[model samples]
Target chain A: MLQTLTFFALAGLVTIFALGTLVLRNMFHTFLSFLGCLLSVAGVFFSLQADFIGGVQVIVYAGSVAVLIVLALLLINHKSGDLSRTNLWSHKWLGGVIAAVLVGAALFGVIMFTHFTGLPLTGETAAIEPVPYIELADGLLNQYPVAFEAMAMLLLAALVAAIITTQADDKADKKAE
Target chain B: MEFVNNIFVNIADLCRALFVWLLNLLGLPVGLAEVAMVAVYWLGIVIVCVFCALFYVIWERKLAGYIQRRPGPNRLGPNGWFHTVGDAIKLVMKEDIVPDGADKNVHLLAALLAFVPPMLALAAMPFGEGMTALDLELGVVYIMAVTTLASLPVLCAGYASNNKFAMMGAMRVVNQAISYEVPQALCILSVIMVAGTFNLNQIIDWQTGNIWLVCLQPVAFVVYLITALAECNRAPFDLPEGESELTAGVFTEYSGMRYALFYLAEYCNMFVAAGLATTLFLGGFTGPFLPGWVWFLLKTFVIMSFFIWVRWSFPRIRADHVLTFCWKVLVPLMLANVLVTGVVVYLLA
Candidate 1:
């Protein structure tokens, strides 16, 4: 009963924050809302007993990715005066339609395909034990070694690419000077 | 000795029983008893966090004064014991100022949120034998995750303040936090490799069964200490709020209780870092005589004193040097430490 209530509460929070992210005029406020949304999603994951994934979600998305995005936003929009104007979309309707369609598709897919195992679909409370981290690690490293290694390689490539692009910018600045 | 060691556990059980009994007597659902117990546990942790912050703040000042051959905060009370309490009162009584140009909502929110990361990180930390508040299986990861968000509130404060200094400080915070987190995580990874578990309690158990992890992975221990100092924004890596350059950095525009919250959060983060070091390296709650909780506090205070000593002893490094050192020096060293530890653990297994 408590888990169900907690999950629904978090889901409500996620919805509110996600909407706030889209509806907020100021870019920074939008970012904060987006962060709230991410954290609430992580809370939902935790409610479902996916502790490892929840932790990674917070660490990766809310921690690194969100910070990077905000940093970039601040760098690009140096003037506080322009904060409100920066988040204005040129094609608002198109963007809204695209977002709506994507969300609808995701919802449709989940409703059609995914099985809600051990979840309290009805009003009955279910006891779901958390999956041990060791088994999770074993599955990732042994069962899906290729995918894991590939993901690492992809991240490394992205890092190197970022470094190269920044270096290239520095070189071009020197050339211009 | 055993009873003393398990004093907190016994108290906790007693409280739970009392709560359950009361709920039963009142004809209430027994499930609410667990929720009430959680609230009590949270209250206890809040008390611990506040006291830890207050004690450490005064201790840091006293240590700093001694380092400079002077008495610190001696006027407030005996040995300036009540200095922090007075300061807390003063902070509370002071005028709360929000800059006209600042985002008022974010400015206010930042102060409240600054307390979240450290408090959340504390939830996973094992203070003594069977004294963890949350006791999550992925305690290490949870700590790392929450601590990573420590930069977020600072960033919000900087951006909201509409001050260039605050903005610069926020940028440095993200830079330093992200950079140092690599080495810190890698250091923890090495310990995880040796312990073969992410659970903080199990890690402590592993240390108790064997030897302290510091002896096995000295490099990781040292690296962890350095990165932890950096992670907590302690000198000489305190570039984020470098007073000399940024005039209190992200805290430039904050005043009154809001500023106090930030200050308290910094000390709390330091305490959490020290607690983590004690757990990860100093064989948490393990020692002769005394009790588990006492040993834990002793170890944590020792680590915190070391932190304060380092803060006063060293000069702040350049921002670029800090990042360069983390990536060039600490990261590679920790990666090697992780690799070597992994290989050794595999062989032993």
Candidate 2:
């Protein structure tokens, strides 16, 4: 009973922060709310007993991604006056509505597809470890080695592409000079 | 020694037993009480972390003063033991300052973001065998991830301050943290491959009287030490709060308890980094005579003092140089260490 309550509380917090991220006028507040949402989602992960996932969410998303977003904003959009009245949804309400509908559809599809055997599982079902991260290493390294290798190859390609683009930009600047 | 070790280990079980007994007396099922008991365990951990932070700050100050050939905090209480206590009082009593045009909510939230990560990181850190708060399977990863979250608060504090120096400090910190994490993670991965598990206690067990990983994985140890220093934002890597140049860095606009909280987090982070280096490299909680927790504390403090020594003795490098060293030098070295360790472990296994 207590677990369920804590779960709802964290889920509600995530919902509130997610809405705040989208609804806030100021970009800075939007970023803060986004971080809050990310953290609350981590909290939800913790409540689900997926502690490893929770930690990764906070470390990668809340820590790196959110901080980078705010830092980029601070550097690129230094003047507060310039962002006082950002018309983010001025002419893109249709696009916003479409995105919202798509998200809703995806959520509905997930709810419909995934099996949710409501709480108080029988002995056999409840006996499972209730965590998936324990087998993630083996699954990634052995069971899905090809997929993992592909992902690594993609990352390496991206790294090479980034270096090439930056070097090319330097060359272009030198030539122009 | 056994008695002392059990005292720390039983704290969690004691809480559960006491709560279960009370819940039973109240004619309630003790099932839900387990969740509350977990909360009690966390409360204990947080309390211990705060006290440790206080003492560690004093020790760091005294150590730094000694290194500089100066008397450290002699006026507070008997060799300045109560110096941190006095600082705490002063901080609490001081006026809270919010710079004009600062983001009020984020300014307030920044302290919380800074303070919470180190405390949470404590949950995964084992003081002795079975002496962790959470004991998650991926204990090492959990600690690394939670500590990484600390950069967000630094970013928040800098951005919310609306000061250029604070922003610059935050930028430096974000870059330093993210860049160093790659090498740090690689170093840790090398250790994990050798230990063959992410459970910190299990890893320590691998080294109990056998051989400390520092002997087997000397290169990883060096990489881990350097990256750990960078990760914790300790000297040479403390460009985030570069006082000489950036003028107090991210906490430039912060005052009173808010500023103190950031420092508290910093000190606690130092302990966490030291504790991690101890657990991963030095055999954690393993010694000849004293209790496990005692050995753990001794090793962690020794590592932390080394960091303090380096902080005071070494000059801070330029920001670009720091990044270049991480990306160009440390990353390749760590990657090589990881590959070598993996091959050796595979052959031995």
Candidate 3:
């Protein structure tokens, strides 16, 4: 009963924050809402006893990714007057179409792939045993090596692209000077 | 000896029994009773953390004064023990200021959120034998995850302050934090590889059964210390708040109680870091004569003193140098350490 209540509470929070992320005018406020969304999603995972995934969610999304987004925001040189205008509704129809399609696809994936289990109305289900980290590691490295390596390569490519882009900008500035 | 070792465990059990009995008398459900116990545990942790932060601040000042050949805050109480108490009162009584053009809500929120990560990290920390608050299986990962969010509040403060210096400090914080975390995670990974568990308690048990990880994995221990110092934004790695350059950095616009929250969080972060070090490397809560809690605190204080010593002894490095050193020197070293540990573990298995 408590777990169910906790899950619904976190899910509600996640929905509110996710909406705030989209609707908030201020970019910084929007980012904070997005962070809130990510953290609440992690809370949901923790509620489900997916401790490792929940931790990784906080680490990757709320920690590294959010900071990266903020850094990018800070890097953009904008006057105080332009601050509020940054997140104004531009290309609204296109954005709406894209968002709708993305959400539809996610819903479709969930409906198609997820296995839903019915819970008892009263009392508690037996406590779920946590998967050990070693088995988790083995599953990633051995059972899903291709996916793991592909992710690693994708990240490496992104890192290299970032470095190259910055280097090129530096060279361009030198030439202009 | 057994009784001494289980002292905290006994106390905790007594509290839990009393709490459950009271809840039963109130006709609360079993599940609600358990939830209430968790809340009680969190309350206990918060109280302990606040007192720990207060103690650490005064301790850091006294140690700094000693290092610099001066008496620090000796006027208030014996060896200025009540200095932090007075400071806390003064901070509370002072005016809370939010800068003009600042994001008022975020400015306020940042101060409150600054305390969250450290407190969350503390939840996983096994203070003594069988004394962890949460005791998650993924304790190491959970600590890493929460501590990673430590940069967020500073970033929010910087952004909301509407100050260029604060923004710059925030940028440096993100850069430094993300960079140091790689090595820190890797260091923890090496310990995890050796101990064969992510559970902090199991790791401590492994250490008790064998030798402390510090002796087994000395390289990882040293690297972990450096990364931990960097992680906590202690001096020599405190470019985020380099007072000489950024005038208190992300904290440029903060004052009074809000600033005190950040200050308290910083010491608490240090305490968590030191606590992790004691658990992972210093044979947590396991010593000959002293009780487990006493040993844990003793080891933790030793590590905290080392952090303070290093802070006062060294000068801060340049921002670029800090990043370059992390990526070029620390990352590769930690990677190699992990590789070596993996091979050793495989061989031993």
- Model 2 CA lDDT for position A107: 100
lDDT by residue (tens digit), candidate 1, B239-267:
98999999999999999999999999999
The digit string of per-residue lDDT tens for model 1 on A1-177 reads: 777789889989999998888678788988999999999999988888889999999999999999999888877775553444324444556776788799999999989898776775465446677867788879999999999999999999999999999999999999999
Number of the top lDDT candidate:
1
Off by over 4 Å in 2: A81-88, A97-128, A131-135, A153-177, B10-14
Fill in the DockQ of model 3.
0.90
Candidate that beats the other on DockQ, 1 or 3, i.e. the better one: 1
Q: For every candidate, what share of the true interface contacts is present?
A: 1.00, 0.88, 1.00
Sort by lDDT, top down from the best: 1, 3, 2
Cα interface RMSD of each candidate: 0.5, 1.5, 0.5
Mark the 10 consecutive residues where model 3 chain B has the least summed lDDT: B29-38
- Residue B195, model 1: lDDT of 90
Clash tally for model 2: 0
* Model 3: per-residue Cα lDDT at residue B203: 95
Show model 3 residue runs off by greater than 4 Å: A81-88, A118-132, A162-177, B1-4
